[model samples]
Target chain A: MNKPTVLIIDDEPQIRKLLEINLSSKGYAVRHAESGKEGLLLASSHFPDAILLDLGLPDMSGHEVLRQLREWYSRAIVILSVQNGEADIVNALENGANDYLTKPFRVGELLARLRSAIRHSDASTVVQTVETGQLEIDLMARVVRRAGEIQKLTSTEYNLLALLARNEGRVLTHQFLLKEVWGISFQSETQYLRVFIAQIRKKIEDDPNRPVHIITESGVGYRFQ
Target chain B: MAAVKLHPFWQFLIGTASIALLAMVCYALGDSMDQWAVALILLAAVSVLAVLFDIIPVLAAALLSALLLNIFFIDPIPDYKIRDTESALLFFIYLFIALVNAVLTNRLRKQEKKIRDREEKEKTIKLYNTLLNSLSHELKTPIATIIGSIDTLKEIDPEIGSQQRMELLAEMEIAGNRLNKQVENLMNMSRLETGTLKLKRDWCDVNELIFLVIQKLPATDTIRIRFEPDESLPLVKLDGGLIETAVYALVHNATRYTPKQTPIEIVTTYNKENNLLIDVLDSGLGIPETEISHVFEKFYRLPNSGTGGSGLGLSIAKGFVEAHGGTVCVANQAQGGALFRIVLPVEISRLHV
Candidate 1:
């Protein structure tokens, strides 16, 4: 398999150097963009699997760059900003950013998010079948079974469960889950997701109160294992 | 105060012309009207001129009118002599009234101008006091933490474990971020105050925005925040940076006030009117009934609530939301928490697939 390519678009030399060293050490092919304009050009030319963008840039605002990129680029664009303001992060994500990491973020957390983004972007990884604990999900057949018994799930519940089971161990944000399962319009209906998650937990877990399969990353999202 | 720029030559000419015209009219009507009536009319003219003209022009008008009254209407025509005692008394009273009216009117004008200036100065002083009071604590706390942690890391024993070193670094990071947040709040407050905060409106996905906010905040193992977004909610056009700052402030405030490990919930929905409603609810000690209205006032902290914040967060949130043509309000939830609700209007076209 070819090594995944990552792009770092940041004006700060130190930040770029740090990310480059860390990503390169992890055996991933890395590219760099010093400014938003350059970042856009490189993103188009290379079509990197994932793009790490900084909100503050020299030539143009990082927001404008993300806006232009989202117009054409369908791949993941994770924002790395020194601005920890909720509005800044929200704006970036709402504008089509895949994830966000504030400055001084742990290297471990950054790598995990980058890996998840890249994994989601790769079309080949849409696995046909996923088996975790006592649960079995067949994406092709659109069926879920537990302990050799076919479990009854509504179409929406099945889709929600299937999405979580496929991307096992990676935390799927409520927004991402809603968008993927219920479409873009339903991305904010978190209550629907909660109800579905509870239903799925009851069906798949030995104890619904203490779910071992679907874990809630409080104030963040849900991760399935 | 700047001097009232009245051309002296013009004002004097107008004042002289007005007095001469009044004298001619009074002389023409001398046969039908009495001297006292004429004198009263001339005094009234001086008072009218005082209201419209500067002090110098009004004084010139008043003096000219008095002299004209004496020469043209006070018993002896075209002369300064006053033979009748009653006529003399009338003449003196008319002059006294004109001079008093001019002086008193000018004094009143000056007093009004002083009051206006004082009000403006008081407003500015109040703003500065609020900023300075909040900054003393906001800016100092983070800096003090950063300095103390750095000193410990540098001067402390080299035998400190890696874990201890990491903890020190984390402290410094948190302190530095806190300092940065305070600075950001200050800048945002300044922008709001100066009316320079330009909204860079864009089509925003509300779900993504909320998730991003939650993600950016340092996840505390104690506070459990759940974000519930409406599935049918449309894309909103807003300055994402500003709205996110506002929502974050609310969440941060929730975390700060609530006990550790308490639950804070964020709920977003598209109302019937196509407006986006975001609710940040915290299972903490709810705001006092009397203090709810004052919560958004700059530097307003609940009395006796010993919390560590600049108290600019809620006000900043209010400023940001209002900038977007939205309204943010707080209420004590019946279920035991404070609810901050933000409602933003979303254009129909902005909603999409």
Candidate 2:
């Protein structure tokens, strides 16, 4: 079996070398690019399982690369950035990145994140299914089953449900969920999130009045249990 | 002889008329014994008004009165004008005296105004010079550190141990962050001095802000940082970034001042007195009472202290805290350390987060 491959795109040569050595030592194929243009070319040519992208680049922005990747690829895209503001994180995630990592991160933490990303992206179709209590989710097939009955969901609703389900135990901030489901622009219209969440609860929860899975984080956003 | 209070033009007219009258009186009384009395009265009255009203041009009026009295009140009457060669010579001499007095008084007024304007300009220039000196000294230290660190990183090889590499990288990161923060402080100071950093109030968790501040301090891992907040510390409406930056500056200052092996303590507490206090106490060399006031002034360092700093840390911290409706103060602790205290008013809980 071929080892999983990861691509790292950063302007700093030292950072690129550090990531390259660390990931290569962990038995993953690692390719490095110094600019966004080179990174996008390598990403398309190699079609790696995941890409660690830096937001600030010399040639083009990290956002542009994320947009192009999302157009053709469904691979795991993780943003490696120095900008840790909630808005920027949400924006990057909205632009089709699977996750975001702030700079000066520990090598151990980076490795764990890369492992998690690669594992998720390489999952077989049958194992990609998520089951929590009576809810059943077939991610690849874009179908949901509850109490032995199939539940119909629009593409948006399905994506939102899948995101919440993926991060079930963590508090998903409004920015986090907005960027994940609707992309960056949808962050401002949080009311849309509220309406969709309500519709989702109506479809999934036995009583929308007393939600069991999706919980609102008040001013922050929502969390799934 | 009436009190000679008059405007310049009026004084000129009155002086001319009075001189003519004096001359006529002298001519009419040429053989009488009261000829000098009219001339003396006119001189004394106009001179008194000239000094009293700051209208020293009245001196010119007095001189004109004397000239007319000499010409017409003495031996030059009926014609009421100069006829003899000696009388014409005296009239010319009195006219020269009046012109000299007017020129002297005008020169004095111009000199007084010039002195006043020069003093004002000197005061403004002094203030600007002080500000520039402080700003440049504060800016230079951090920039130098950043440049030095970058140069060092470039010289090191790539195959160093993970620990050594990490330390160097962390140092570089610290220097970069310090440069970023110093620039931010300069910008904020400019904004504050220009009155542009308006507060944008929002619901914020004070605990979360404290956590963020801790995250910024990598040195805190070595030092024992103790953060203890009140159980009922409610959500506060405040400018989060400004407060965070202020707290970070305070922490960075504390860490820098404290000894390497000593433990630094950061405590957060709130009281019913309507204030939230953050105290960063360090077991380091305490500042003398003489230097406490100067600590918050930009670029003013203690005498003979070799601790390298841009010296904008405390001043910027103070400015940012004050901008957020808070106050910052420093004092030598009782136990041989420095204690920096920041007090921010507990904002009214607006929106629940």
Candidate 3:
């Protein structure tokens, strides 16, 4: 198997240096750029497997860079930013970024997110079934089973769960989820999402209050683990 | 000017009504009171309104008084139009004096307000300077230590012993962690002070929120933080990020202030009013009653407390909680411990999709 290439676009020299050391030691090829324009140029020539794009770029807007790369590139583009605002995170995700991690992130967490992003992007084939813990979701059958027993779920509930399960370990924002499960007009109806999520948690989670399979990403979004 | 903010409509009503009352009083003393005296009194009333109330109300009062004077005080008995030259001259002159008084007093009040606003702005700048000075010290210490340790490591790269190298590396990590914490606190404080701290609310499970907060805190050998979530707690809508930071601050404070091997407990429950309640209890020495109130104040540290924090944590916590229209308070427990409680009015989700 070939080693995956990871490109990091960050203006801060120390952060770039530390990330290079941390990532290279884990046997991944790391390329870096200090500005958004340079990053986009290098990305075209390098065709890296995964890109770490910083939101606060020096030359142009990082969001603009992400959008430009996404126009042609079909690989994972994880965002690295100092902005921890929910709106910022949601905006990045909505603009086609695969994952978002705030700066000063733990090395272990950054590596994990990178691994998940690369792993998901590498799988060209469609996923038919998603499994985590004792919960099993069979996409073709449109059936959810808990502990080998078929758990009854409404059609809408099944669609919502399957969508979340299909993108396991990646956060799906409320707007995205509502638009996908419901419609674009239902994007602002977060109350409906809340009610459905609570119902799903009750049916699947051992403790609905302390859910582990379906993780809430603060006020930004939700992720199925 | 009175501190009480009377509405502009009420001020206009009161000012106009007072002028009518004065005219009626002059009518009761019909033969004795002079029309000139009534005009003088009305001009004085307009000036008083300008000084005490807003410009719009004062302007209205001035116009109303002029009309009142023309209708009753003029020589032509109860005539809307002034016929004689003396009465007409008196009307124009009275109108002129009343308008001038209103304009002058209004300008004076505006200038006074401008001076007051500038003074307040100066005070804010002074406070910002104090915060910056304190932050410099807090931020520089960790950075200095990190640079010093890293430099020493670089110079003695080959000669340093394994244990010594490990110690230096650990020291660097500690300094780096402290630096990161201070930077985070400074960013949060800036967001709060600039009025940019907006809550991004969503449906969240409080138990999970507390669990995540605990997972984020640095692990220590001396104390252990425990959580006992209410089993029947519903998924409530809230800004999970803000509430997490608030609860984290309270629990982190307990770990820093208490003795080693102390057990910290976090309990969550909803009251009858459907407000989500979170309590962080510590079995350490309780806070002094006098210090409790000041604990949540910005840059307020306990007199006997050791130095580690920039004294912004609790204040930031209070700010975040208050942004949610919530309340956070502290009380010493009966069993010689301190309890920090946060109460937030949250919408409980009970629907089944």
Best by DockQ: 3
Q: How far off is each candidate at the interface, as Cα RMSD in Å?
A: 10.2, 9.7, 3.6
**Position A41, candidate 2: lDDT:** 91
Q: Which DockQ values do the candidates obtain, in the order shown?
A: 0.05, 0.05, 0.41
Better of 2 and 3 by lDDT: 3
lDDT of 1 at B165: 91
lDDT of each: 0.81, 0.70, 0.85
Best by TM-score: 3
RMSD for each of the candidates:
9.9, 13.6, 5.4
lDDT (tens digit, per residue) of candidate 2 on A127-215:
57778777788877888888768888888888899888776543466767777788988765454565577668768877554467786
Q: What tens digits encode model 3's per-residue C-alpha lDDT throughout B1-353?
A: 74237987898789888878878888788878788998988888887778788877888888889998898879877888989899999999998988888888878878888999999999889878768876888888888888888898889788889899999888888888888888888889888999988777776767767878887777672239877766578878888888898898898888889997789999998889989899999998898998888889887778878877878999999999898889999999998899999999888878423
The weakest ten consecutive residues by lDDT in model 2 chain B span B47-56
DockQ of 1: 0.05
Using lDDT as the measure, what is the rank order of every candidate, best first? 3, 1, 2
Error (Å) of candidate 2 at residue A110 is 2.5
